[model samples]
Target: MCDTCGCQLHEHHHHDPKVVEVNQSLLAANVQQAMSNRQHIEKMGAVAINLISSPGSGKTTLLERTIEAMRDTVRIGVIEGDIETERDAERIRAKGVPAVQLTTGGACHLDAPLVHGGLHVLEHFAKGAGYDLIFIENVGNLVCPATFDLGEHIRVVLLSVPEGSDKPAKYPATFKGADLVLLTKVDLLPYFDFSMEEVRKEAGLLKPDLELMALSATSGEGFDAWLSFLDRRLNR
Candidate 1:
């Protein structure tokens, strides 16, 4: 069984010395592949963003809204990672954006090699025109996703209003690795007991310089700042 997620693949067992060595080897391989993937994305004329969050944290919704808001100005593509489903990729395609779905079977997170494959498919779908922005919507899990870098230029972690403010404290490693932390579903704030101040404090403690934004994809509240952030990244 895998120590990290208890899957039958045994890809991440670390209790025994042999397993530890194997894990290390696997991570090293992933790192090398991730570096190559970065170069591949650059060659395709695109910057990739890895989006990480727990299930139901509004990651997909944010992407759909982002595509709707910027599809005209930005040549956006998506690589959707999920345990099992073409559903999210279908959603992105419905928005008139090219999307590649990568199902990890039962794995909790996406590794670099998987994303490397997805990038190729995305590029093929682009038909040599290339892309300005590529979003890798990672499998819906915060813990495992943090350990594997998928060659993204920016890592954004989402916390919805209903997910509570304590998520940062609970998932410190994920937040620490994030370049930006988004508080999604802000329109639900009036109905939920979530605290923006607490989220800011805990997330700030984990990442002192983290760029934080609160936005609602449904209501369009605080959504412009999110778009502006993407614009700035594309311009940079």
Candidate 2:
């Protein structure tokens, strides 16, 4: 059981066959929608990326900076997910990119069905210009978002320095689902007790070959690598 949330994270025996069947059915439906979402994105000539992390992990700031850096060279679209408010989408719009905000109405995560609608809105925003990349910023929770695929080509999880280095081990499931991990707020390293070595070691235990990068979006320190990572994916 998770000490913080009281949620079961490991396998356990369930005698209720109906409950098991229902859960399986729900997940299967989600998978089908996710596959369709992937096809839709491909048809739009774009690759989608899902970003998952806890609140205050600098996901929006990272997107803001990334849009500023890549806007001229890449046709980008954003889908910002939150439990409430269109604030994040407005921020992206301020940067002049097509952004759709999906408010989950108190839900903890954004599911494939929810993102499907957002994708359509984003497509409308493109007006047939087409996009090179689509960024889906999942609701700011590590746990629930990990269960939904959202049809992304890559999944990037963020861990800010202020959040502590122990997060990777503490939230093993989220880290394990990541294709790449970003250690944000690196500029605060000297101020916080966060250890880069500990983060790398623990995350490696979850995913041995997981690509990791440390950057301070505020400072632009190590930011170039992030742009290159996106460029490589877009080119591929």
Candidate 3:
């Protein structure tokens, strides 16, 4: 019975709920765009990587460093996502690599459609220069971003040491969806309360085969593994 007006279930009543059986995931639109985006990325001669993490996880900084590290050996491009501003893309462009920024206005996550547009923009910037790998740095978010697929071959989730180690257990869905979990800002371990063991244990419980690495982008600690991982993915 409808508590507001007490309308009968079978009668022609406004209070009766429609109960439309639209058995569809909230990410349906995103999934469709992802399928198309994957094809688009392949056509552009590159594999894409979607990086997710909470605010201040050093995603942009890491990308800046990554461009310096791999731009010469591997043709790298980037699509930066943010609520507003093209600062990240500007930073990437300074590295002499083509980059495009997709500002979401107020969206918390970067969906596949936005990335699809960004890919085209990047192509325009490059104008047939080509890229071996495209990094779609997602909006700084650990929750809603996990639900949407940007057609990336690998989804990397970053966790800075200052954010602590309890994030995996706190946000299992994000951790489980990750193909690789990068623990950043590890150089600050002595000052922070982060526990490496706990983070790995929780993340492992969620995804038994989840690849993980601990490093600091600032200190250049544990970066070779990340570069190797990227090489393997691109070659594959």
Residue clash pairs of candidate 1? none
* TM-score of every model versus the real structure: 0.89, 0.89, 0.89
User: Residue by residue across 1-236, what tens digits does model 3's lDDT show?
Assistant: 76556766745456446668898987799889999999888887898999999989999999988889998888888999999998988999999898888999999998888888898988888778777899999999889899889999999999999898999999999999999999998889999887899997999999999999987888999998998899888855
In candidate 2 the C-alpha lDDT for residue 4 amounts to 48
Single out the weakest 10-residue window by summed lDDT for candidate 2: 13-22
Residues 1-236 of candidate 1: C-alpha lDDT, one tens digit per residue: 77586778866554545533344555898999999999999988889999999999999999999999999989999999999989999999999999999999999999999999999999899899999999999999979999998999999999998889999999999999999999999999999999889988998898788999999999999999999999988835
Clashes of each: 0, 0, 0
Q: Which lDDT value does model 3 have at 83? A: 98
Error of 2 at 224 (Å): 0.6
Candidate 3: where are CA atoms >4 Å away?
Answer: 1-24
- Model 1 has a clash total of 0
Once fitted onto the true fold, the runs of candidate 1 whose alpha carbons sit more than 4 angstroms away are 1-26
Give the TM-score (vs. native) of candidate 2.
0.89
Clashing residue pairs, candidate 3?
none
When sorted by lDDT, best at the front, the candidate numbers are 2, 1, 3
